[model samples]
Target: MKNFKNKVAAITGAGSGMGRELAIQLAEQGCHLALSDVNESGLAETVRIVKNRNNSVIITNQKLDVADRSAVFQWASQAAKDHGKVNLIFNNAGIAFGSTIEGFEEKDFKRVIDINFWGVVHGTQAFLPYLKTSGEGHVINTSSVFGIIAVPGTSAYNASKFAVRGFTETLRQELDVMKCGVSATSVHPGGIQTAIAKSSQINESLKSLGLDPSHAKDKMAAQFITTPKKAASMILKGVRKNSRRVLIGPDAGFADLMQRIFPGAYQVLVGKLLLRRMR
Candidate 1:
């Protein structure tokens, strides 16, 4: 929406990274916030930051695990009740696991999908009704550059992000067909300086597969070319314009360009990059 003042925005994963930054910025814009995170301390910190902003913003903080579909629905209802109406839902809760498809444990892979892919699904479906009731609404789901291009040891993460991209795109189309004012945008953020890599659970078996887990994490941190604050600002700008897809970094734009130009051939290019990293 062009104006954010007095609007109610609900953000998943509001404890840190882009989510926290979005909450803070929205507060400054006079938007009331419903912030949730599995990390209680981080969520509290986010609430405190938003409340301390110059605007008198309403803040609701809750410990939520987005993977739980029922809980997400419940939270949406509660947030609508607490804030009077919901105009935006940032389905930003996500996690990553480092593993080849062969090296990943079935359970671990499922865990990643539950939080990363299904979490977006849960948040979207849960809040959609409330959004429609608000007359105008937007859903921002976080995908990744990995969603556009697959990497050697991030199968689960790639799968989830790719799914998010597809789902959000389809949701946007459906909203258009239904003539609903609620719109959705899929976000592809190239390596931002977030704890995602450090928080990643690497498959120990990756070493046997000739990939160094420690080195991979290091490479990940090195690739973080954008700050979360910058990413958050870009996201809000995209929301105001109702952008269909928001690409957050130069690297993300480059990857999207390469994917359009090379398509399947880029897999081989990425393979070469992986080998170079191994060396």
Candidate 2:
């Protein structure tokens, strides 16, 4: 927990963005890695980058869909087998979706929940036993600033992220009560520069709210000031400190503050800002 040297970590969504940066940084610190992602090519690239930098670090990868419970358990078992013991599981794999609650499609909403919420559940349950056995462990679940404060045109995404925040917090409390060596941190990243926006599923329902679906990705990306490297560094620092919650960027910090100060009234302010942006 103090350092990653010689410790083994299993990361979901290790192919790109903060996930890839985490793999790179952990390798630099001499941690062995078990990486998984649905994108085979991206997963390969991550492995390649890590190997090129640290030949001594052992790296194993799988083409994994974190939404699949069985597959996640299998990967967890394999990671434990390959690395001998697992100290950390970063449930970082998630997808983005944009839709108005009234206009949302069931299928689209289900997809978002399955990937963003259920994926974290699967990863945490799958890897937790191994972590307990390791005697020192941490669960890092990626939420979002929206988890702290909701906005329009992202009902499904907000639901999933809020679910992650609640789930991780309860898990952390249980781990503490049990006096387990394992702990959990809920991460709220405020639009770190990532392909999530470009790759997001923006529903036509957003147009019902007078928001241009086509411009949604660009608008979201424009808010991403923190780099992936910076986000990863913050996350690792949180892990080392055993922090209960990790806010990645200044925007996340601001959102948390606003929510704390205004609570219910912040929703109105957010709505006004979003309406101004749409104009």
Candidate 3:
């Protein structure tokens, strides 16, 4: 846990953004990587970059949808078989959705939950055995600042992230109770620079809440003050320390503090700030 050298790490969403940066950094530190992403081109690019930078690092990649339980399990098996043993699983694949609860479509809500929440579950369950066999392992699940504080027009995203937070925390506790060498950390990241905004499902429902869906994505992207490389570095640091929760940016730290101070009252401040942004 204190070092990554010779460790085998499986990372989902490794095509770009934080995932790609994590792979690159881990490779630089002498870690072997098993990478996957739904974006085939992006995945290839990540592999290319890792190879170009660290030719000695072993890597295997797959075009994967983390929500697919069988596929994730299969990939886990393959990664362990190929790498000899697996030591880390970064369950980082996620998607964003923006809509009010009243305007949210069931299918869209399900999609966000499936990929953002269930995907983490699948990755953990699939790779857990391999991690246990390795005798030193870590599970990193990506949540968000929204998981700590809710705001308008992001009900689905908030739900999914919140679920991830709860699930990962519980998993971490169970791992501790079992005295397993494996550990888990819930990652609450602020707006780190990533492609999530461009690929988010921002529906017209935001209009019903006096928000403009057309400009929402751009507005969200503008708040991304942290870079993916920095986020990746912080995450790895957390893993080395075996932190129970990791907050990536200043915004994330502020959100966590606000929730601790205001709890139920923070909703009003969040609503006002979001409305001001939309206007």
Q: What is candidate 2's lDDT per residue for 1-279, written digit by digit as tens?
A: 899999999999999999999999999999999999999999999999999989999999999999899999999999999999999999999998888898878998998999999999999999999999999999999999989999988889999999999999999999999988999999999979999999998878788778788998898788789999999999999999999999989999999999999999999998889667764
Residue 172, model 2, lDDT: 98
Ranking by TM-score: 3, 2, 1
- What clash pairs does model 3 have? none
What lDDT does each candidate get? 0.90, 0.94, 0.94
Provide TM-scores for the models.
0.97, 0.98, 0.99
Clashes of each: 0, 0, 0
- lDDT tens string, model 1, 1-279? 898999999999999999999999999999999999999999998888788884488888789999999999999999999999999999998888987777788999999999999999999999999999999999999999989999777889999999999999999999989988899999999989988888888877677657777777776677789999999999999999999999999989988998999999999997678657654
User: Which pairs of residues collide in candidate 2?
Assistant: none
Kindly report which residue stretches of model 3 are placed more than 4 angstroms away from their true locations once superposed. Answer: none
Instruction: Please give the TM-score that candidate 2 achieves against the real structure.
Output: 0.98
- State how far residue 230 of model 3 sits from its true place (Å): 0.5
The TM-score that candidate 1 achieves is 0.97
RMSD of each: 1.2, 0.9, 0.8
